[model samples]
Structure formats: structure tokens, C-alpha cells
Target: MRQVIQLRTEQLGATARTTLSARSALAWALIELQRHEEAVAQLRGLLPLVLAAWGEHHEAANGVRLHLGTAHFASGRPARAEELTRVVLAVYPVMDGLRLRAWTLLASALSCLGRHREAADEYTALLNAASPVYGEDDRQLLWVRTDRLHQLAFLAEHDLVEQESRALLAGLADDDPLRAAISGAHAFVLNSAGHHAPAETIVRAALAHHDGADLCLGLARSLNGQGRHEEALRILTDARTRCRQSGDTEHVSLLHTLTARALLGLERLDDAETQARQAVEAARTHHGPTHHRSLEAATTLASVLAARGRHTDAREHLTHCAAAWRRQFGPHHPRTIATDAELAAVPKA
Candidate 1:
């Protein structure tokens, strides 16, 4: 199934430059590669052509619009993305696919804008729509469902709903290993939400069940979130080494970012800077400059530069990151907002 999806996505990319099919293909390829900027660019370029050929209300236009909205959200332009998604949903009320895609994008955009309540509503709608179409037993469907649940958990704002969502994820462990890894992600989210002890327990359980690099990275993130910087560093370092051995450059870049964060937390400034720089280089080469993973690497490098008192260099990197993120996601996304915050935090001499 995964391979089929990959092949379909790749075919879209192979045809992107000269045809509308190419735009669709490029969008799919870029999204899979985590290259939101490039994905958004392809979608934006293709959208008008699609709309012109098939009118704004046509199904094909609506379909491409749905994807364009996602590209916007990924690139950090939530408001624009939201606007496009809204138009699609409004025009194609019977399109379950558009409904699902639009709501997801809406939730993401709202989250980026810090509108938690709206985001939660959108997620709830998404879950409701997905449950009927995908069913409970389908793994791909469950993955999307669980992702919505995770977002709801984050937007809950209170522990009651958050804990409820966590419990739900934990219960899925036996039924779904992928979901179990996602449950691990939920734990990291919990830690971010300030519920450390429960997060730790959930992550530990997840680590025991899944030995994948992503799961390990999630565990390390949870640990770091709990202030166990050394443990996080060690885990990330090991993960990086393993990814390198496995030729998983994407995972290696991810681990490097995590390691850099841990090092930063430990006040190992020099080492943090080195790792951050390395991560940027690796991400650009392996994941490409427009990928979310590469942007993360760039963000980490900028943070490290700021920490090392190279404010100018840090600003430059942040500026580049901001521009790139805007191009990919639309400038209003949470990731982009966070990047802006990081830039703002840099000390000016």
C-alpha cells in the first residue's frame, strides 16, 4: 500500500513540469519528501491552470484546491490555505474527500494561528467525516483518524481531554503498531503540554513496543521535554549512528536536530552548533531545501548560531527559513510563527 502510494506520488512528479498531472505529481512527491515549499509552489502554479480549464466549481478544480490548501498550510500560509479550503468545501458539499482534506487543513491553519478552539472544532469534524468513510479497521484510515485525535488532544487546553486522548491512543497499542508509534508522539505532545510523568510512562511503553527510528526519536523528544537532556542526547546520538548505517539520511538529519536540541539544553554550545550545522547540510542534501525536515534543520542551526552569540548569522538563517517557510506554507502557519519567534528571540548587539 505504501509503495503504491509512493509510486502514484512519484508519477505525479515525473509529469509535473509540462502538465497538470505534473503539478499533482510534484505536490504528492514534495509532500512525501516533506518539502512543503516546493509542494506549495507546484500546487500554486497548477491551481490556476486547473481552475481555468475546469471552472472554479468543477470537481477537478475542487480536488486540486484541496491539495493546494494543504500545501499552503504546510508552507505556513494558513490564512490563504484556509480561504481556499473553505471555498472548496463550500462548493463541493458532497465531496467526502474534499471535506476531509479541507477540515484537516482548516484545523492546521487554526492551530498555526493559535486559535485552539477553532482548530479543535475542525479536527472533530474531520474525525467525524473520516470515521464513516474509512471505517475503524483500516490502517491508513486509522492513521489519519489518530492524527486528528492527536491534534484534538493538543488543542484540548486542559488535562481532562488531553488525558482522555492519551488513554485512547494507549489502548490502540495492541491493535495498531503504527498507531502505537503515534501514541508515542501523543506522549511527546503531552510533555509539551506540561504533563511530564504520564508522558514519560507512555513514551517508555511505546519504546518497548516499537524499535523504529521515529519511535526512538519520539522517546528522545519526550525525554528532552522532561528535561532529561543527557538521556535525550544519548538516544539521539545512537539513533543518528543507526540511521547513518541504514542509509536513512532523513532520519539522520532528524536525529541530528534532536541531538542539537539536547546539547543546547545541556549548554554544550559548541557541540550543539556543530550538530546543528551538520543537520542543515544533511537535510538540504538528503531531504531538499523545501522539505519540512530541512527547514527544521535550518531552524536548529539558526538557534545554535544565536546561542553562540552570532546574532547576525542567526538572523540571516532565520530570514531564509522564514522566506522558505512562507513559500511552502503561506506565512501564517504555526511552524512559521514559531520560526518567527525564534528569530525574535535572538539578541541584538
Candidate 2:
């Protein structure tokens, strides 16, 4: 099925170089394949062509701009991405898909830039609009609302909002896949905020219903939060196998990163370092160096180096992390602040 989709996408690309829908489809395919840099490049090339063909104010042009912004943001060029997205939002009031998508991307870009307050506002607006359009009971609306809750939880560096969001999401029908995924993510947020007991329960239930690598990854994370390092390692190992079996290299690389964390928790410093490096290499191959997944792997590798007392190497990794975060989220973003603090705390050799 995946191969068939890939072939169709290739044929579409060859058949219509100037068609906006064709370019958009290709861009989405690249993103799903985790070829973020390639996606960004394709969108950049396509955007100007779209603008020329449809003019700046045309609805089709606005759609291309939204995709272009998202591609840039995913590729770690958040400022450029935000600028394009802002233009779209400023021009279009309530065009179908435009407002919601633009606000979502804008919020993400703002969060990366370290403007958490601004990002929070964007999320709030998105939730408000999405709720009206899809209603709170709608599965798609619940998913959008859950994403906003995640952004809020991250910005606040707390889980109260996340817990509340999970409660709401849990009330959703068990048959809804999107709700199940959101519940899994909510569990992860709770684990990150140190609410392990409830998180474990939620994640385990979520894993039962959700077969995606992300759900498995979240379960592993929650287990790690509970100090069940061995369990976490086993879960990640299973997730890695599943990803490989499914030919999902991106998730496979992510599983490697989680394995590195679990190894670190187990005090197996050497193995942790090895796993972290492997994850970084794999993520770079799949998503390129500037991608969020690659940077996350790089950060994990640096943390492992720091734990091993390799101060110089750790500092280099932290430097890369800081620069990447700055480029993708801006200098003042909470995530950037956290990375900067990590970099600053490295012992001088």
C-alpha cells in the first residue's frame, strides 16, 4: 500500500509540475516520509510558482503559503515559516482549512521562537475556532483541542492542564482512534510532569488501543518515569522492532533515542551513548540534521556525553542544540531557554 502511494505520488509529480494540488500532495507525502528538508525544498520551489500562477490573493495561493510555512517550520526555519503563515492569516479571515492550519503553524513557530505567551494565544484562538467548526464532541475537534492542551502544558512546564485535558479526552468514545492517540500523548505529558502513577495507567490503556509507534514510545516514557528502566527498555525494543517491520525508519530512530534514555536510567552509560549516537545518525538520514527528530536525538546524545564526563563533546552537542533551537523556535522560547540552561551548566574542562 505504501509503495503504491509512493508510485502514485511520483506519477502525480511528473504529470503536473505547476498544479498546486500536485505540489501540495507531494509536500504532504515528504512530511509523512520524514523527509523534512526535502519537503521544505519542494514547498519553497512550489510556493513561488503557485504565487505566480494564482496571484497573491487567490485562495489557492494562500493554501500553498500555508503548506510552505509548515514545511519551513518542520525543517527548523521557524522565522521564515512564521512570516509566511502570518501573511496567510492576515489576508484570509475564515477560509476553509486556512484559519485553523495557519493558527496551528503560527503557534508552533512562536513556541519554537521561545515566545510561549504568544504561542499560547495562538493555541487559544485555534481551539476556539476549531471548537465552533467541529464542536467539542467531534473527534477531529477533540484532537485539535488536545494539541492546544499539549502546547499549554509545555509552556506552563506543568501537567495540571494536561491532566484535565486527558480527563476530557478519556470521556470520548473508545472507538475513536484520534481520541485514543490524544490520550496516549496526554499520558506522556503527565509523565513528563512527574505524575507517574496515573500516567502509567493511561498510557497502558492507550497502548492497548493504539498500535502506533508513538503510543508505544509514550508507554516506554511513562514506564521510565516510574523508574522501571528495564521495562522501559523492553517496551522501546519492541517498538523498535515494530517500526522496522513496518518500514517506518523515523519511528525506529525515535525508539533508539528512547532506548538511549532508558539505558541512561539503568546507569549503562556506554550503551546509552552508543544508542544516542545511533539515533542521531538514523534520524539525520531519515529527516535531515535540521529536523526536530534529528535535533532531539542529538540532544540525547549530548546528555549521554555529559553523563560520561565528556565535557568538550557535550559542550559541542549543546552548542548545536542551542543554535538549532534558536533557528527553529527563536532565542527566547521556553525550549530554547531549557537548552541554553543545559549548555551553560556543562562543566568546563
Candidate 3:
């Protein structure tokens, strides 16, 4: 396909080039190959040609923009991806699969930016819009629901996530891959809500089927919450090794955060502080300062500081963190309430 595009590039007219360019297909192939920068560059070059040949609102041009959005996302530029996807959605609303892809991409970008509430709402809207077209039980809708549940989990909507997880799990076949995701999400909510034993059980069951970083994180959190530091560290170490081997940097901050908690439980204050700081820096660099994970990492760092008798510093940290969580997740959210409580509990200097 690349060779064909190259061969026809100089010979074809604008209209012929639009058909021969196969911009979407080439961009997807490059993205799949993990050549993100190359894909982005190629797509940028193709967009003007597509627009000139097919006009701005034409389906082909919109498809090119959508692919460009995906490429931007793949390249770790979710903000740029969000902008492109919003444009595509504006001009190309109600197209069959294109609209669904645009909505999904937009929601995912928002989630990556730590706009969990907005992302969950977007996913809800997408599900509503797609249900009549794709049916309620469609696999795509199920996946979308799974993503929304994840966003809700980030917001610490424990009850809703748990309820949705069970319903989604019951609807899936035993062998469905989504079962692992649903189970992992449920365990995450359980762990967040302090049901360590139940969370451990659910995560273990899910791990029996799929060995993933998320499952490992959930299992480790369960163990950590139960005060089993050694076991949690072991699980985290294995997960970290797998992540390093696969070059999966997305979950590294999470691993560090959970490891810090386990180390803190073991009274390794220095190690805990080191890990916590790393988690905060990494999460902030990757997800931006206000992202859910970044704020969680900051909260973890504050706990380490408090444990080390740095009450003044801890109070300052929680002061900023609590306000951010309150503004982003609402004052009633578990995270916001917990941050506020932690702040109040800090002793005066």
C-alpha cells in the first residue's frame, strides 16, 4: 500500500489522489506499527490534499481528520487529539461508524487529561446516541460502558462502578475478554472503598484469566490495604518487570504509587517517600498536574511527609490537593472528602 501510494503520488490528479492516497489506511498501519510520529507527519501532509480534493465537510476529509486525531493520541498528544476529534464531530456528526469513533476518541482524550467526570458523561452520551443504532447489547457498547466504569472508578464512584461492573460481567460470556476488565474494575472500586478482602478475591479471580498491569495493581492495592506489604511489593515488582519489558510506561506511575503505599505500611519511610515523589513527578509529567493519578500521587506523597513528621509540609500538600480534587471531582467525592479529612487531621507545626 505504501509503495502504491508512492507510485501514484506524482501521476494522479487531485480527485484520483484522494482515492489512491488511502490516507486513513496508511495512517492506521503506521499507528499499528507504533510509528506515531511518521503517521502524524504523513497525515498532516495528506489532510490539505484530502480537503482540497473532497472539500472540508466531505466524508473523506472528515475520515482523514479522525485518523489524524487517532495518530495524535497514539503519539501522546491527547489535547491535540481532542481538538481534532471535536472538529470532526462538529462537521461529521451522525455518520455510522465514524461518529462512534470520534466520540470514543474524544472521551478517551478527555479521560487521559483527567477530566473523568466529563469523560464519563461523554461516554454516557455516546452510549445513548449509539444504542439505537448498534443495539444495547452490542459489543462496542459494552466496551464503551467498560471505559465509563473506569472513569467512574477514578472519580471514586464506588457503588456505581461496582453495580455496573456486576451487571456488565453477568452479561458477558465466560470466555469474553471484557470479563477480566470488568472484574479488574470492580476490584479497583472495592479496594478504593476499603473492602480489601473482597477486592483481593475479585482481582485473584480475574488474574486467573488475564495477567495484566491493571489486575496486578488492583491485587497489590488489595494486599496493601490488608497490611500485607511484602506480598503487595512482590506483585508490584513482577508487574513492573512486565511493564519494563513491554515498554508500557502508562502504568509505571501507578505502580510507584502503590509500591509507596506498601513501603509506608512497612515503616520504610525513606523508601516510601522516594517512591511517592517519583510517582508524583512521573504522573504529573505524563498526565498533567491536575490529572486524577497525579493528584492521587500527590496525596500519597503528603501521607509520606506526614508519616515523617513533616506536618507543615504535609498540610500544605493536602491543602492544594484537596482543593484540586474538590474542584475536579466535587466536594462529595471520596477522594476530595478523604483529602480534606487528611488535611484536618494534620497536626500544627
Top TM-score prediction, candidate number = 3
| Per-residue lDDT over 16-85 for candidate 3, one digit per residue giving the tens place of the 0 to 100 score | 7656367668887998898989989998988876776656787888888988899888777889999999
Candidate 3 global TM-score: 0.92
Cα displacement (Å) at residue 122, model 3: 0.8
Off by over 4 Å in 1: 1-53, 71-79, 112-117, 129-141, 152-158, 161-163, 170-178, 189-198, 212-214, 225-228, 239-261, 264-267, 272-349
lDDT of each: 0.70, 0.74, 0.88
Candidate 1 residue-wise lDDT, 1-349, digit = tens: 5455445545665353246655687687887787878887788777776665556787777878877777766565777887987887788777366676677777666655545456666766766767767775555555555555554544333454455455556546454576565665577556556676677786677667666677678778777777899988788877777777775654777788889989999989999999888888876665456666687788888888888889999999998998877766556555677788988888776
Worst 10 residues of 3 by lDDT: 1-10
User: Each model's TM-score?
Assistant: 0.57, 0.69, 0.92
Q: Model 2, range 66-99, lDDT digits (tens) per residue?
A: 8778777776678887999899988887735677
Rank ordering of all candidates by lDDT, starting from the highest: 3, 2, 1
Indicate whether candidate 2 or candidate 3 has the larger TM-score. 3
Sorted by TM-score (best first), the order is 3, 2, 1
The runs of at least 3 residues in candidate 3 whose Cα sits more than 4 Å from the true structure, single-residue gaps closed, are 1-15, 18-20
